[model samples]
Target: MKIKDFPHAGETPPFGAGGSGVGLYIHIPFCKQACHYCDFHFSTSLKKKNELVDALCQEMILRKDEIPGPLQTIYFGGGTPSLLEAEELAQIFKTIDSHFEVNPDAEITLEANPDDLTEAKLKMLAASRINRLSIGVQSFFEEDLKLMNRAHNAIEAVTCLELAKNYFDNISIDLIYGMPDMSDARWQENLDKTLALDIPHISSYALTVEPNTALQKFIEKGVVKPVDDAVAQGHFEILIERMQQAGFENYEFSNFGKPGYYSQNNTAYWTGKSYLGIGPSAHSYDGETRSWNVNSNPKYIKAIQSGELPIERETLSVTDKYNEYVMTGLRTIWGISLIKIEESFGLKFKEYALQQAQKHIEEHLLFLDQDRIVVTQKGKFLSDGLASDLFLINLS
Candidate 1:
C-alpha cells in the first residue's frame, strides 16, 4: 500500500504535483493544569501519556497508506507537547521517519508552555527536528494569568521568549485579549512587551467563555465577569492597527506573521490541503472525507491496542465543501477566487455567491478585489458573520 499509489492522492489539484503539501498534526492531550477558558479535549493527568504516545505512533503506521506524498509540515499540538521527554520525542520521530518521507527542511512545530521550556528542554528541542515553537504566553501580567489560571507566571513568560529566541528563529506566541476587566492600557502593555521580544509571529484571540469550562462556570456563578463583545472588538482593532504598523502581515484572522514566517501547518489547512491528525480528539482531512478519533484517552488507547482505529468518518457534500471554502477564504488575504468557485462548484453556486455577497459589498463589508471576493477593512472584524451570510443554506 504505497502512499503515492493511492488515487486522488492529495486533497488539492496541486498537492501531489507540487501544489499544497500534506501535513501531520499530532495532538498530545495532557496538560499540567487546564486553563479556565480552554475547552479542548485534554486531561490533567499524565497517567496515560506513555501509552497514548504509543497508540499515536501505531495509528500513524496503520494509516500510512492515507497520505499522498512527503510531509511539508508536522505540528505537535495540545496537552503541551513540550511536556514530553526528549526520549519520547525521539521514539515518535523514529517511527515517523521510518514510515513516511519527510521533507528535509520540513516546518516541524511544537506547542510549548513557558514553564515547561526550561533552558535544558530548549537545548534538547534545538538539537531535535522540531524547528518551530508556538509558546503559550497568554499574558504578561499576574492578574491576567491568575484570572485565566495559567500555569506560567509573567516572569516565566518573558524569560521563555528571551531564551526561545536564542534557540529558534521561528517563534510564535499566543496572546488572549478581552479578558474580564482587562483595560486598554493593559492590553497595550501586553502588545508592547511582545513586540519588545521581537517575536516573528503572533496568534491572538479574544477570551470567550466555553460551555462546561471553569470560566463559564465562574461567569454563571458571577465569580468572574462575562466577556464583553464590544470590548473584544475594540481590542482586535487595536491589535490589527498595531501589528500592521509593526510590519507584520495579518495573513489570517487571529494570525499575524512577518514575511516568510507564516505557519505552514495552519496555512495548509486553510488552503484546503490534506492533513493526517493523530491522537485522541484530533481530526484528519483527505479532501472529501473528514475523520476524527475518540476524545477519551483510555478509549483511544484501547481501540488502537485492539487493532481498531477508533475513528468516526464523514464524507462532505458538495455544498459543505463550498461553505468551508467561503468561510476560510474570506478570513484570509488570498480571498476567494471567483473563477475557481465557478469552475469547481458550478456557475450557479458562483452566481449565488456573488448575489449573496452583493449586499455586503454595498454595505462596504466585502468587495471584489480583481477576480477574488475579499473582506474590506470595515468588514474584517466581522468576516466570519459576513461569510456565513453568503453560505448556501439550501443546496437542494
Candidate 2:
C-alpha cells in the first residue's frame, strides 16, 4: 500500500510553523558495505532485516505515550534506509499512522544512497508519504568514492539526481571535502556540479580519521595520508564563499539551503525540540533528559520481542543544559541569545557567558549584535572551538 493512502498525507505544513511539534527519527541500522571512515553502529549483513523491522514497529508502539503531541517531522536515517523494500517501508508507515498523531503536512524524509535510487525506486518513493530525500552522494568523483568505499559510483551519483529531481522536489545531497589529495580546484568542481543540478539543500563535512576505524589504520600504515586541519580550513572557506554566491544560506555549520528548503527535522534538534528516536542505536531527547536504545541488532530485537526496552537514560543538569545550548547555538546562524541564557539558565549563567565571549569579541572572531553573541565570518570555521570556550565547566 502507498503512503498517500494514509490520512496524514497532504501538502507540506507552512515552513517554520511547527517549532513546538515533536519529531520522530527511525534508524535503520543495516548497510550493504561499510565506509572506511564510518563508526556508526550497523551490520553489513541483512540476516536480521525482517526481525529488525518488526522490532522497530514494536518500539514505536511501546513508546507512543512518550510523545503526546502531533509529529511535525519523521526522518528515516541509517546505515541505509533506502535498503528497505516497499512493503517494509509501508509496514513502518502503517505503524506510525496507527499509534501517533502525525500532522497532515509533516516533513517526512528518507535518506538514500545514489545507487539505491533507481528509476523504479524513485517512483515508489515519490508515491509514498516521504516528501523529502537526502541522497548520500558524498562526491562526484570516482577516486573519492573508491577511497571512501561508498556504495555508489560517480556516474550513479549524477544519474540518480537527474532522475530523483523528476520525482522529489525537496532533495538534499551530501558532499565531503578535505580528503587527502582533494585539491581546492576539485572541491570547487564538486560544488559547481551540485549547483548545476539545482539541488535545494546540501550538507558537507570534512573528512576526519576516527579512532579504531579503517581510516586510522590506513594512516598509521602510511597507506593513506593523515588529515590536515589547515587544508580542511582552506576548503571550508572555499565552501562558504561558493554556497553564499549561490544564494544558499549556511544555516548551520555543515548544512546549507535555499530560502525555503531548510531541514525541519534537523532544525528542530538544533533548537532543542524533543524527538523520539526508534530502532537500534537510536537516541531520544526530551527537553531535559536523553536516552538511547541498545546498539546491538540481535539484543535490541530480543529485548523488544520480550516486551522490554533495552535503553539507557540520562537527565540533564542545569550546567549540562546551558553547555548544550551554547554548543548548538553557536553552530547555527541564530547565534547565542544572551537573554535566553539569563531566562532559561539564570543571571549568573548569562554573566558568565558574556564574560567568556569577551576574548572572542576583542579578537574579531565574535561580535555582539544587540544582545546576541554571534560568530564573525572569520570565526565561522572555528565555531565549535569558540563554543567550547564559552562552555561553563561547573555551575555549582
For every candidate, C-alpha RMSD to the true structure in Å: 6.5, 7.0
**Per-residue alpha-carbon lDDT of model 2 for 1-396, expressed as tens digits?**
332222122222222434458999999999999999999888999999999999999999999999959999999999999999989999999999999999888899999999999999999999889999999999999999999999999999999999999999999999999999999999999999999999999999999888999989999999998899999999999999999899887878899989888899878877678899999999999988999999999999999999999999999999999999999878777777888889999999999999999999899887776667777778999999999999887986
Judge candidate 1 at residue 298 and give its lDDT. 96
TM-score of each: 0.95, 0.95
Please give the CA lDDT of all the candidate structures.
Answer: 0.88, 0.90
Over 94-190, each residue of candidate 1 has an lDDT whose tens digit, in order, gives 9999899898768899999999998999999999999999999999999999999999999999999999988999999999999889999899999
Model 1 — TM-score against the truth?
0.95
Instruction: For candidate 1, give the lDDT of residue 224.
Output: 90
How far is 258's C-alpha from truth in model 1 (Å)? 0.6
Candidate 1, residue 300: how far the Cα is off, in Å: 0.3
